[model samples]
Target: MDLLHTLTHRHTTKAYDTERKIPAPVVAQLLEALRYSPSSVNSQPWHFFVADNDAGKAQIAKATSSPFAFNASRVMDASHVIVLSARNTLPPEYLQTLSDQEEADGRYANADARAQAHKGRAGFVGLHEQAGDVPVWTQKQTYIAQGFLLLSAALLGVDATPMEGFDAAILSTELELAEKGLSPAVIVALGYHSDADFNARLPKSRLPEKSIFSHI
Candidate 1:
């Protein structure tokens, strides 16, 4: 695939074709991309809630009420909606769980290597905890996963809308994410765009690379 062409053509979808649905196989691939998304220290502190059915979508759409009403249709009409969430706190147990998983996955050649890996990741988590920025740090990682999902969707010929306009409190309550020690970071709607999507027809715009980049 032409990577530049894909990036240039991908746009945030506005209106979706309600009649269209993404094939299950394609959805699986998108989820895989999200699973492999990178995180600082390999913390992997995230959980995803996927909604494909009307009831589930409606539950998520509740958060888009009031000022965010504009995103309701995008949520309700899309083929799939994923609520990306981050851990409320990165407790030692959680960090240890990740360490154990890494060992199980053969990420370490020996016990000493495993211990060093855990120490490195825990040190970073400790720094964030001391700064009272654990939540912020984890949310940043969640957005990395969001980026992966959006790009993967684009590559699969699926339209995607990354939404941060929803009411977090409403979404957290509806999804009971807080009960699971998670908080909603973002929502992504995926489907095919409809004729009503004005954004699809607009040309892409951005500052020149020379203006945004600097060379040593």
Candidate 2:
């Protein structure tokens, strides 16, 4: 599919068909896309929790209850719910882990190359820590991955709704993210649009390019 067509056609799906499910292979590809998503300094400080079954989705839906109850049905009805999380800290050990993986993957040309790679990435990570908000910085990187997932899902003809309306604290507790040193950043529900999804038939809307973009 053409990139423009996919972007133009994709909209925030408000309702989903509960019975439609994504194929396992397609789910795998979407996950691979997330795994390979680019991050600043290759920090890659994010984890994804996927709920593809009713029981799992119900657990996630619990976070959307009460004041956020409107989102509960969407979470429950979607074929899958993906909770994207950011690491609470970008410690030296995590950077070392990334460096080790890179070395194992032959990303370094030599010993010096490996050393330089670690130095550069570690320096960038230090800047975030020195700024005193590693969580915010790390959460920002997760949005980049979310963008990739949005576009990839469009290409795969999957309807997705990116949501930040739920209770983050509730989600964190429900997912036990604190135990993993992670916090919820965003949630995306994926599935087919329901026949009653009025938004799907509406023309996509956006501000004029002249007002929203600048050539300079």
Model 2 clash count equals 0
Question: What are the Cα lDDT values of the candidates?
Answer: 0.95, 0.92
- Per-residue lDDT tens digits for candidate 1, residues 99-171, read 9999999899999999999999899999998999999999999999999999999888999999999999999
TM-score of 1: 0.98
* Candidate 2: Cα lDDT at 192: 92
Compute each candidate's TM-score over C-alphas.
0.98, 0.98
Give residue 72's error in model 1 in angstroms: 0.4
lDDT of 2 by residue, 112-213 (tens): 999999999888888878889899998999999999999999999999999998998888999899999999999999989998888899998999999988
Worst window of 10 by summed lDDT in candidate 2: 121-130
Judge candidate 1 at residue 125 and give its lDDT. Answer: 91
